[model samples]
Structure formats: structure tokens, C-alpha cells
Target: MPTLSESRSRLLVSEAGIPVSNWETADSTQEAVSLAKNLGFPVVVKLCGDEIAHKTERGLVRLNLKTEDAVEEAADELLSSVTADDGEVTLLVSEQIRGNRELIVGLVRDEQFGPCVMLGIGGILAEAVADVAFRLAPLSRSEASDLIDDLSMQSLLDSFRGEPAVDREALINVLCALGDLGSDQEVLSVDLNPLIVANGVPIAVDALVETVEG
Candidate 1:
């Protein structure tokens, strides 16, 4: 597998037919403000440099910001919040996505399975419910069975009484792709938590990826 050894290039997550906000790479303070006007309405700003991870935890990400002035202010604030140990920082300003729920899809390498996939109810309640399931890579229909039979979180996927049910099949597709990634790509780490499934469909709201070391 070809390892992601370059620090200058960022991973691009483009999917055909999926409606996502266009993200602009802001190289400077003035450029950030100019990009915001074109991005329109409410937006989110974050440090996209290789040196930064845990942006939310570090207070390096700002949300629900509207207007060029707020963007500029937030941009400066985000830049100053964390020091760039990697020398320079690249920033991203994107349109904000609105939703109430959060779901997680991720991968963890297992010695036996090589690369395993994980899915669960995300956010604060995930811990309480322990709503998570795992499956081995190169998943087929039979492998998806583990998610239904072995995982303790199946109840969350259903609709009882007045509640609505999520698109279960769509979730399964994500798992299949993760399995493919583990087998085909040298994926060290990935966090697609809180994928923002709404009205029975899933879209990645926030994500993080790291290259695996051989």
C-alpha cells in the first residue's frame, strides 16, 4: 500500500451526488475574509494545518459564524488559540451544516481481522447506551450480520411508537466502505463520528484521518 508520507497535501473527501458545502482553502487572513463572502450566510472556520488535531478540544474551531467580519475575527481567534508546532497553518472556512443528531463510523486495526470497522450512536449518550457494533474487513452480506447480531446497539436503529427509523442500509454501506479502506488503503486512523444522519440518510459532518505506519 502507498503510505501518505507527504505533510503538504491534504486528503480530499469528494463523493459524487452528495450535497456538501464547498470548502475554501484560506491561505491568509485577508483571503479568509474574502472567501467567507463567497461561501455565504453562516459558516464554520477551522485550522486545517497538519500541526492541528483535536480542533474542538483545543478551541481551535468556531461554529455558527455569520458575516465576513465575524469570520475574520474568528479566524484570528482560531489561529491564536493554538501554536503551530509544524511552522505554518492552513485554514478552512466552510458553510455550516445544521442537524440535531450525531452518529459515529470509524476503523480500528485488529491483529486477527487486520482492519475492523465500528459504528454506534455517537455524542454524549453513546457511552451510556454502549450502542456500538464491530465487523471484520472485506465485509460482505454475511459480515454485515455481525452488526445486527453481535452489536449491542441494534435497538437504537429502530422506530418505536412516535419515533422515526434511520436508513439502516445506508449505514451498512458506510461499514462496507470502511472495510474496503482497511483492505485497500493504508488507513492508520479515521473518525467519522457524528455523521449527522437526518431523516434516515447519512452525511459526514466532521471527519479526521491519519496515515498508517508500516
Candidate 2:
């Protein structure tokens, strides 16, 4: 099995009608700084490579960089860190999104159940919370809605700390798309974690896709 790079994974998800944050890839600190200027301040710099997962754990992710100097420094560090390990690296410069609500949407193939879509409470503590739900692929709108309702932490979807309520319809569309992706046998699994809800809109901030060998 081969893992798709985060940028490629996000592109695939975006093509499936899921909203994603604006981002650019750069190979040098200068290019990264230029991209950050165009994307505006308070951007995130992450090392992008097929071999690089759990970027935060490897210090390959830098967040909330509010200035060009910070972007330059972080980009340089990320490039060096990943290059040291993989010999080549690309840096993803993305808009920094602020949100309190986070969710996970994924696809998996089960021997008995076949393809299934998953929804869960997401973020750094996602594993700990483990509030998740699953439904067969190719879900109907009603089934998607039911999946949302299945979350144990339903309150997170509501307006919290002054933020607007999550757009349930958008989330349904995401789940439905994941279902469609799962229906494709080539795709083994999909992971869209910390799908941040900002001002009621859900944007996938990070994504990964695993595929079977052809």
C-alpha cells in the first residue's frame, strides 16, 4: 500500500466537493515566505511528503505564524527536518484557521460490511474521546444526517463560545462524498482529521488516503 501526500489527499477530497483551506507548496524558505504573503499572515507551514505523517510529532508542523520572519524560520526548519529524513521535501503553506469545533470524516473497507463512512469528534484528543459513528458507503442525505446525530458529543455541533453552529448540510455532503470514495475499491482508507468548523463552515485542514496496490 502507498500513502498519498497530504497535498494530494486534500486535492482529492476537494474534488469530491469537500471544502478545504487555500494552500500552496514550496521547496524553499523564500518561496514559502512569498506564498505566505499572498495567503496573508497567521499561516501554517507543514512539511509535505508521502513518508511524512504525524507531522506535529516530528516537529514538521508550525502553526499560527503571524509574520514573514516566522514563516521563513519555520519553513526553513521544516524543510531541513524532512529533508534530513527523506532527502526531499515540500512545504505546504496554508491559511491559519481559528475554530473551536473539530470533526473527523473517513472511509474504510471492511471485509464483512464492505465500504463504510465514519464520523467522529476530532482534534488532539480525538483518540481519547472516541466519539464516533459509522454508516455504509453511498449514504443517502437522511443517512448522513443520522450519522451526525450519532455522535456522543452532539453539543459540539452547536454554537459554542460565540462561534456559529456547524453547517450540518455541508457535513452531510462530506460524509456522502466519503461514502462515494469508499465505494471505489482502489481506495483502502481515508483520514480527514480536525476538519475545523469556522463560522459554521467545515474545512478539512489535513487529509490522508491509503490505496491498494494496482
Candidate 3:
């Protein structure tokens, strides 16, 4: 199997109507700093490359960088780290988003079910919680709604603290699109974690796609 890079994965999902954070790719610390400045302070910086996945685990991700100096330092460290491994690297700078709710959306192929869409609570404890629901591909609007309602922690979607309730229609759209993508034989799986909700809109922060090898 072949896997799409983070940037490529995000692009593929975005083309399918999923909302993703705005990002720019850079090849050097200086370029990363410039991109970060252009995107504004308190941005996210990560090493990006075809072979570099699980950036957080590799210490390639820098978050909430609030100063040019900080961005420069992070970019330098990330570039050095990734380059040492692959001999080359690209940096990705994105606008930092603030959200308390994290969710996961994905697709997988099953022997009996064929393509299936999955929804679950996400974040560091995603595996621990294991609260997820699934539906077959090409989900109808009603099926999409049921998928959300099926989650063990449905309260997460309701208005909590001061945050507004998650936009159900937008969430439904994302799932339905994923369902459509799942139906493609070329697509093997998709892992979209930390699909953060900000001001009621869900934005995909990180994603990975596994595709059938030629």
C-alpha cells in the first residue's frame, strides 16, 4: 500500500468538500518564518514530506508559535530533524485554531461491508475512549445524522460550556463526502484525527490516506 503525505492528504479531502486549515509549504527556516508571518503569529509549523507522517510522534510539529523568533527556532529544529532522516524536507505553516472539541472521521474497507465510514471522539485519548460509530459508504443525510447520534458520547456535539453546538449539517456533509470517497477502489483508508470544532465549524487539522498500490 502507498500513503499520501499530510499535505496531499489534506488537499484530497478538501477537494471532496472537507474544510481544512489554510497552510503554506516552505523549504527553509527563512521561508517558514516568512510564511508564518504572512499567516500571522500563533501559527502552527510542521516538517512536511512524503515520508514524514506521525509528525507529532517525531517531534516535527510546533504549535502556538506566537513570535517570529519562535517560528524561526522551530523551523530550524524541525528542518534539521527531518533532513537528517530524509536528506531533504519541506515545512508547513498553518493558522492555529482554538477548539476544545476533538473528533475523528475516517474510512476503511471491510470484507463483508466493503467501504465503511467511521465517527468517534478523538485526541490523545481517542484509542482509550474507543467511542465510535460506523456506516456503509454513500451515506444518506439521514444515515449521516444517525452516525453522529450513534456515538457513545453524543453530548459532545451539544453546546457545552460557552461553545456553540457543532454544526450538524456541516458535519453531515463531511461524513457523506467521506462516504463517497470510501466507495473509490483506489482509496483504502482515511484517518482524520483532531477534527476540531471552532465556532461550530469543523476543520480538519490532520489527515492521512492509504491508497492501493499500483
Put down candidate 1 lDDT per residue, 149-200, tens digits, no spaces: 5666566566633446667677667667666777545576556755765655
lDDT of each residue in 117-165, candidate 2, tens digit only: 9999999899898999999998999999999999988888998889989
Per-residue error for 28 in candidate 2, Å, reads: 0.7
Rank by TM-score (best first): 2, 3, 1
lDDT of model number 1: 0.64
> In model 1, which runs have C-alpha deviations exceeding 4 angstroms?
1-21, 125-129, 145-164
Q: TM-scores for all candidates?
A: 0.78, 0.96, 0.95
Query: At residue 206, what lDDT does model 1 achieve?
Result: 58
Please tell me which model should have the higher lDDT, number 1 or number 2. Answer: 2
Residue 135 local lDDT, model 2: 94
**Residue 168 CA error for candidate 2 (Å)?**
0.7
Query: Judged by TM-score, which candidate is best?
Result: 2
- State in Å the error of residue 132, model 1: 1.1
